[model samples]
Target: MRTALAAGTAWLLATGLTAAGAAPAQAAPLQAAPAADAAPLLDAGSADGRRFRATGRLVGGGGTTCSATVVHAGGRPDPAAKALVLSNGHCADDTMGTNDVVTDKAAPEGWTFTPAFFHDNVAEQKTFTMERVLYATMKDIDVSLLRLNATYGDLAKLDVTPKTLADRRPAPGTALRAVHAPSDGIEDGRRHLRQSRCTATAAVPALHEHTWLWKDATRTDCLGISGGSSGGAVTTAGDTGRLVGMLNTIATPGYLGCGLGRPCEGSAEGLVVPKDDTAYVTPVDAVASCLTGSGFDLRRTGCRLDRGTQVTVTPDGRQTRSTTPDGPARWDVRITPGQGTRPTWVAVKSGPFGAVDCTRPEGYGTPRRLPAAGLEHTAVLPAQDNLHVLCVAGGPDATLQGAAWAASLAHPAYAYVRVDNTPPTVAPRIDAQHFGEGDDATYWVRPVYAPWELTGYQVKYGPRAGTDCADPAGYRPYLNIPASLKASQGPWTYCAIGSDNAGNTTAPAAFTVPSG
Candidate 1:
């Protein structure tokens, strides 16, 4: 279903004006040749900009069309699985349920992917049929990872190399470039695939925590992610072409064929009051987690087996207990010598106690390892009952640290655990009850700060009559928060729920808007 939104409220808002630096040459508009005509974007910047080609257009039997990208995920040395296809879950399959899809779980009939679909050069393009579905879902994350029947050699002629999947998640303000096929709807008839430079605007305001909105680099025009652009690869702006997310949906129409603040081209109904320059994007990390969890071996670029490094956790001291039963349990932890600088803090995962969630706590500071000495560290476990120490270690970052735990040694040389059944810490309060003016009305809710990782949140609002605000499916699926809502001259009740990365949602925090 189309993401729910308040009537007459314009949710699509472009936040950037300058093109993302280092993005591939400006994308050729549909039907229009690129100005530079630089070397084709071949092999993910392997052979200069002239030879870069990793994006493709996907067409299905039921008239469902979108874009696709070839990604490298497994067997880094030789790439166990070289050409895994990544796209939006809704592109291949249209079935969407309350939490997920229903049936007929394969790519729709006649579904095919054409890589290097540049300049409409039919002979130079290579087409591949989807062979298997590695992992796909629409409920929580709108991503689909699939295996194609074509080999690396098939794409090699098109000068296409599998793009690398980013290991990290994206935050607001992250610069991005969407390499996509803006079909007739999104584009103004330009034929070739285009690269629209944009930046992530928010993580969880209108839609789910996993879905984010991005503003186009151009201030005057919309990002214009139309039908054919669905499932296109959205990569970082640098030369690596590392996959960060994929085009899911336009979500809302920003303008009715008119530039921002200008007269309507056709009808005023097409305008999103504030003019939405954003599109819905499903993150690559979510796709990777789902694909890997489903027994697929996706290869990652520059991550060969021999080159992979294991982090070593060295315990500074034996576990120490508090004299009082309800006090904090503590142990010191430090990465082994020669590894590098000391990690700010140790991430712990206890089976009996619970998982250490850190999704929402982006940029939040970690408690120092030592009470006095910053160099020496300590693993502080919450004082509770039935908590068993599972694993602890350090890595490049918090997200990577969690990934490192998977490869950690069982009963590692040094590790500690403690119990604290307290639900995740709630935020100080809802950031705001209202934002924007008139048609641009918005509601703001900051993420609840906590030591644990936070995954996402649920937002609900409606007349106080008989609304079941607790039901996520019942709540409006507005991801473009603050911007997607309009202020009304009425007393409307709203609620915000916080969730840890582990999917633990907080009790509803409610507020009401006073009638104007």
Candidate 2:
């Protein structure tokens, strides 16, 4: 997760790819609950305060993630060749085996990811520049870079000139801005936190105490920045259009969207920061590392390197089918290299899904959706040395069909779920919610299960009780949750929407609630 840093102009935050942070209170040493019975390990709105960023996957089982832009040490600008890719170094545990091919011409899902993008590829991509792991001592500074040998692709195409360390140290209190990359599942950019100052420091890992320059706690928002979004940039736009550092990371959620569960709120929520006990990266030269060599002069032309880009290649799927979501669906297997990540949505909706080229604005085209046959299934595509492997589906059950998928941004080819169900994750259950006299309210739920049962959940609300639980009709059920409770006209009479994964669904269990 990204955190406070020495960079100015309200630095941005990064996803996970580093050390661990203050461990949350032990899960009360949980005991096994019924097969599918459980509650939310956390509330729908409390996860944001943990001082971490979303890794775009189910972390600790499930969470939300965002992205930032990152550049190499030395490089020139040319969109055709190189630029920064807002992704993670070792995604989902960096399991990229040689069997997982990073097609120089054909990528897994019709995209080309080079050695520069791999975690081990660090040796190759980092050649032109120096590499130094940021210690937890430098919390909010978990950033790294790859000095490029050439420039092309997005950076050159967009002529995006990044701001240097000096340009960013804003006049204290100057409105610092937060930035985000919607490439992963995020669709908007309103995710800016605040330009903060490193107030004090102690013997902590990669973090530094900061005098956060925020308007108020109510205005702060955060997501767990996990795997895929490794070395990204978190800066603000200067009148000149250059960017600077805000925060970087070492790790994010273990899985994509952390099960797409609603983010946590309240005390569990904390500002994002660098991994634990790591060193700080406040040296101006180090900050300059993200740019070009000092003598190279950035004002003229930007870095001279193309770090990473999406390459298209046909997939190895042999089967094709047709059908629809609401009714019967249809699908054709041209599994060849198609453009875009996050293809799940577009493909699931129609045939193809939305992908990202980051080099441009149009984003990407929709490709075929996954889960070819089964539901709630996950695949493990390792790209360590370009290794590939195939697994067998054990059985066909509801959980199997409607479950989670584990993928790696570095690998992009493999995704699977926890086949073994010994440590079952508990589904979330809403015991009861208390609405006080005025505006505050509290709801109780379960926690994460052993076999990754229920990571957390989704909440909805409305004036009517029996409205669509999965997709609430009105704003009643969600009136109490963080993002949804923005428009509460009265007090704590917030209704319950829906909860899943981490605990048993309340909509299925609770027969009724007081309708507001």
Candidate 3:
């Protein structure tokens, strides 16, 4: 349940203005810091010449982490197939299923890293251990991809697919911008942000080389890059935007360890890699050449190394798309032809406080309500049917009480049928059915894009067994979907219910409990 928006952390990738006389830029905008101001990253910028800068939080209060530009060896972002792109595997590993303990023994070729929480924040900077496998799978070839997790706060949203990373690498020396939630007092408790030049490419393609990598600032006011600042990006300056590598570890590693709810260290250490840090880019090309027994031109997809499938979306007249393994979280959308000048298209799931994750079950991003009480939002099938609407009643035939429902263990159940115009675009017709797909399942909730006045969802289910197939009582209803029946057992009765924002009356959308 990651978000589509990484908020301001990774937002720096947005294209910028480089006109000859571009107006003077203001410092990064930041929130009021906790009274201890400037005490955290107290003396980071002392050393000069370092690149990269950023600030970010862990998902669901994961923890604070920072990001910086790769100046020395990784000065700017590079889309060059030559460099490797590294990260903690779990950054986008939700497809492996939740709570899945991480292990590197199963590391494969294409798996990118995860939210750098455990890796950067662990007690003693753990090397790949049996008990402490890196999250997600790892693709070593690139020297800078390894990472440790850290905790700061929750993340906005992110796009983590092979396709997403494929062409995102910028040409070497591109104007790279970085930011992250600084754990130190670098920028008065606020994020320490910075813009810098990506220097050059790494000499080795091995992922382990990352262990020997270190930072030496040759410039000033560079304190923006501080602790927990791993897994960020280094890009180039231009009309076209790209992603070179993420802000790996930051500034310096501290033995003091322990951050957020985990054991961590190196309050300052930035780490990352070339965009294409995989198991084998060149040799694999030869392998592909040998596999086909012919010179294989596999880079056609534009990625130095193909990672996974790509997912596309036509958002608000834009053709931006996402390509991830677990079926595109579909976020991380960028405008082509013209970069940063346009807005990043997103499904706008939930508002500010309601993000899509376990801890913030409140919803995605922020919380939105039906203008009135007792209404449920939903979407229709087929992308063309975007008439997202709200329900003020139960079954289409149910009374007009405007009963709504917020029934779930995570959220409180409320039932107020006041009829309002605020609700989720009726759950996007449950596509990828991660759960069972039986008749009892609600195939799709249908996103109710625009708001409308209503009572609740029109859920119908049930057909009693052993009763006359044609009898009215045999036709019970449920909010749940129907299941395929065994032999021709008389007409199955189902339940019909209505849901609104406050709560929905559960009368139908149900099936008979199978007997032993």
Candidate 4:
């Protein structure tokens, strides 16, 4: 299982600071690192730590914490230039769905980045506020670029200099060192800069985890990666190493299949889960072209990144919603091309649930040419039972010439639709003795169903014996029996309905509670 490194409560507990600055223990401990290759803590006063002072802890709204580093696109900029910080897109916003891109948005209030963050010198660390989100996306890659309110001149006063971005990804077997502030299982050392020395292994052409897909990820055996290590700087190993990539995720132990916490490598054949524990880094070189001496400019001639497209599907395509099995389902799709984009062709494809390879072209139908002025169309997907995935992609014309055109086709703007028609079965078990006794006797009903097959269960109760099984109204999300009805005398009838991802509901199952 390859899991993202964004930390939740582990970040709070490890740092002993809440969003409100209260010290409280709430989240579970983070996954433990392998004992043989545990990363060593880097002292802030050490020469190497000072050399990489730009690497720091990033704190976002809603208790989200990850590692990030200040970076410059070209040569050192004028000291007055606003600094840029890079991290994983999910680290910036965990709610970001597949193929979603966010740009030029105001930064969340109170979001801060602390450089020179050594666990031993927590009080001395300087925190800078984020000003704006320059670019963020989880489409072909997981990355986010943020602008800081502070300028390079401001950081220079603290003896902190931004790392220079490499023009390209490092070759395989290249010596690498990851500098990050992990707050998971480190106890008192949480937030301290840790260094992991390793070598790049292979480049994954396509990597899939949960709903998001990433491309050209570099796999390495870097140890000590866990919650809060995301967006850490992965640099060439040296006293003056340059930034090559950022830590994105790691192969989690004890998980059997490829999913969340278990990223799988995708190829034409299928998905393959790595057998060993390792960490993956997303390249940052593509971002260099989008930057200039002034700042980020998505319209730059050589920029290959998506300018930010809008793909909306009626009835909500982002999540699984129910529809009639084997029945025609019409989808109204609207795609607004990003600024400066020349999207000439759009295509859609469907495949078995969780089996679609967005990177391949074999399954996609004929491409539809977009009008010069508008990009709106209605698409009808093939009817099927159970669950299926529908993917949409847009790119430049295939006949175009130039590297930029080729790059656009190689990394197109894409979105996914999870359609499900299957309804889950529920078996309700009642516990009579454990709750209460006599008139105050409480009944605890446990609805047992396959979690992968169902989204949730709904329940309703009444004194009447016969209730319509197909009625969709009046049922509430399943919880314990209501306290007001707990002491009711006569027999009570309870009905439970199971709902799946597609909003399809099963027939209600009835249960009777005998009078005491």
Judged by TM-score, which candidate is best? 4
Query: What's the residue-level lDDT of 142 in candidate 2?
Result: 31
Candidate 3 whole-model C-alpha lDDT, 0 to 1: 0.23
* Tens-digit lDDT string for candidate 2 (1-516): 323211111111221111111111112211111111111111112322111121111111012232333343343444444433323222211222212322122112211123212222123322121122121111112322222333434333233333334333333223323332222322333222212222112112112121101110111112322222323333332321333333332212222112111111111122133322221212223245334433232222432121222122222321111211333221121222223332232111111101111112132233223443323322232211111112211112222222221121222221111111122234333344344544554333222221112223345443333445455444333222243221233222333323322123334222133323
Query: Over the full model, what C-alpha lDDT does candidate 1 score relative to the true structure?
Result: 0.44
Worst 10 residues of 2 by lDDT: 210-219
Model 3 misplaced regions, further than 4 Å:
1-56, 60-135, 138-175, 185-188, 192-194, 201-203, 207-223, 250-516
Candidate 4 or 2, higher TM-score:
4
Name the lDDT value of residue 194 in candidate 1.
64
- Clash numbers, per candidate: 39, 194, 199, 9
| Best candidate, lDDT | 4
Q: In candidate 4, which residue pairs clash?
A: 1-252, 1-261, 1-262, 2-261, 2-262, 2-263, 321-502, 322-502, 322-503
28-112 per-residue lDDT for model 1 (tens digits): 1121222222212223333323423777776654655677877765413133343577776666554432123222246545767
TM-score quality measure for candidate 1: 0.43
lDDT of 4 by residue, 351-459 (tens): 5433566546666667677655556554665445423445555566544345544454455554434444545544433333335677776654444333223335687
- TM-scores of the models, in the order given: 0.43, 0.27, 0.23, 0.69
lDDT of 3 by residue, 59-158 (tens): 2113223232111122232323221223323233312211122323332333222222221232321111111122232222111222223211111112
**By TM-score, highest first, what's the ranking?**
4, 1, 2, 3
